[model samples]
Target: MMRNKIIEMRGIVKSYYLGTPNELEILHGIDLDVYEGEFLSIIGASGSGKSTLMNILGALDRPTKGHYYLDHLPMENVRDDGLSQIRNKKIGFVFQTFNLIPRSTALKNVALPMLYGGVPRSERSRRAAELLQLVEMSGRSHHRPNELSGGQKQRVAIARAMANNPAIILADEPTGALDTHTGRLVMDIFHRLHQEQGKTIILITHNAELAEETERTIRLRDGSIVDNRMNGHYQLEACNESV
Candidate 1:
């Protein structure tokens, strides 16, 4: 059986301040494919264009050249409104900073995306509560962002991101702000989402060790893929022996 390709990028070139004295091409003619229900980690050092690729994949930014097909829809020529709609419907982003509204309750924060999608107030609240419960933050639903710990805040953010049931979940340095213990918990949540919920997760991180946890790791260097390994089922002993 042939599985569906959830994301496809061909000859993607993204540049900042184009045609100016300070013009910088961050991504250079990159091509990649991400499939449904696959957990892929994009690993790279600082300033290696991994973030630029992520921004393009999430529809947060446009590529200066080439095409991006997300869930079979080409985003190369999409207007801002169309891009925004595609992002809201097909992609969910989890940022390192959590990006939650400080003044709003966790439930309200999670419900905000659905509200923007015009979901009714009553139904959105119901769905928000369910999502909060899934992230083990139901008890803190009424608490504001300032009242929660970093991990709790991230859990709320995860629930909020899932509110729209997006096809792809783009997590950019999701555990960057957490302690090791909290980071493990967050990764465990993501693991469950990938394994149990069967979500197509794209995790962008600078940490190589973190990439080991995903099903496949694509290492980027100087705006290109240095290595792509599908070592999803590698034994710990085998990895240690190879090391």
Candidate 2:
């Protein structure tokens, strides 16, 4: 069963430089809540602090001032080692860059996270193959990053993201590198993940059009939320199951 809220943020304030006069505050006292199994998108132009907020959400960074909770666990002020464990176990990240190992096969890339989590080699490989199949990449499991097209690499990356069965998937411009058609394909996979698997997906994008595909959209401007509302595209059944 899913929790009432998978993520919650209160009084989030992020800044560069601790106490000096040159400190640049990127996020200003923001409050947000995301329910379990929801598809959410955060949209903003460059310099709007969207990326900074994503970093904090993914446990890559902590707020300069604020409180954040993931699965009801406080995220602020955690030690580096603790943060790393939480990131690996609780969150999955997909980036526009398709950060796959150039020399690793698609199956190996998908299996990497499980490897880090200390799953047995045989079991990791078995689970990796299953995840690759989930993303419709089973036929290309042997291909390396250099051998695949941008979309194919991204599919592999998506499979890799799902390897650990994380509580949330945080995508940073996931479709930004693909062409329009390919981008739609990637988005379709995300939708299937959300609707069929009930994944809690947090997509970060500057494209308003892409953001509209999600159930809820949050627009940020100048370090503050300008809009937070539900889109008509939300499907009630999407949050009902986990595959």
Candidate 3:
């Protein structure tokens, strides 16, 4: 039997400042599907719609046209509360900036999401500790954001993102702030999560090399998907021939 799709987007169109003369469409009729355990990367240059598409997929923004289904629930018809529930329960996000509270300890930062979900204090601490260990940050659990290195801070952010055991993890330029070796370490963690934990990961990056590490790569240009390939394989000859 085929694995169910975790995310489905059909003819997704998004525009900023709709109806005004300055209105500009960012995503144009995007059609994409992500399977339950797939690791996918979306790559594009600056001004491409990769970030816009990521925002829509993560439900941080809604499409002006088209449909989005997350775990079989239609998002277009949901109210704000329903959307928020889905976001909290089904999806997690990591950003390049790490986004951890400067004054909070790593454990506290990771525990905040569970607190929002109303988990008990003991259970929250247990889960947060487990996730921190998963990211190899158990020793630094008491460190504040400022006390950690850039890579360590991002690891803490990743641990926080996984605190709720979300089905999908959305990462935007997750390694942008790290040095080359540290960036590879972060990617190794992501790879292990997909391989061992069966998590669905969608990463957005401007680096072509990073995109090649995923199982699938979607290339966007000027707000459109110029190329999308599976198994992280694309032929220069084929692209040249198409052009």
Q: What is the TM-score of each candidate against the true structure?
A: 0.94, 0.94, 0.93
lDDT of 1 by residue, 1-243 (tens): 466999989999988885669888888889898989989999999999998899899998999999889999988779999988988889889999999999999999999889888899999999999999999999999999999999999999999889999999999999999999999999999999999999999999998889999978888898988888875574463366566
Error (Å) of candidate 2 at residue 181 is 0.6
Alpha carbon lDDT of each predicted model: 0.91, 0.92, 0.90
Candidate 3 per-residue C-alpha lDDT over 1-243 given as tens digits, one digit per residue, 9 for 90 to 100? 467898999999999895679889999999998989889999999999988899989888889999999988889878888777777888889999999999899999999889988899999999999999999999999989999999999989888889888889999999999999999999999999999999999999999889888988999998889898864243553355467
**Candidate 2, 37-142: lDDT as tens digits:** 8899999999999999999999999899989999999986799999988888889999999999998999999999898888999999999999999989999999
State in Å the error of residue 24, model 1. 1.4
Weakest lDDT window of 10 consecutive positions for candidate 3: 232-241
Please list the residue runs of candidate 2 whose C-alpha ends up more than 4 Å from where it truly belongs after superposition.
1-3, 233-243
RMSD of each: 3.7, 3.5, 4.1
Ranking by lDDT: 2, 1, 3
lDDT of 3 at 216: 83
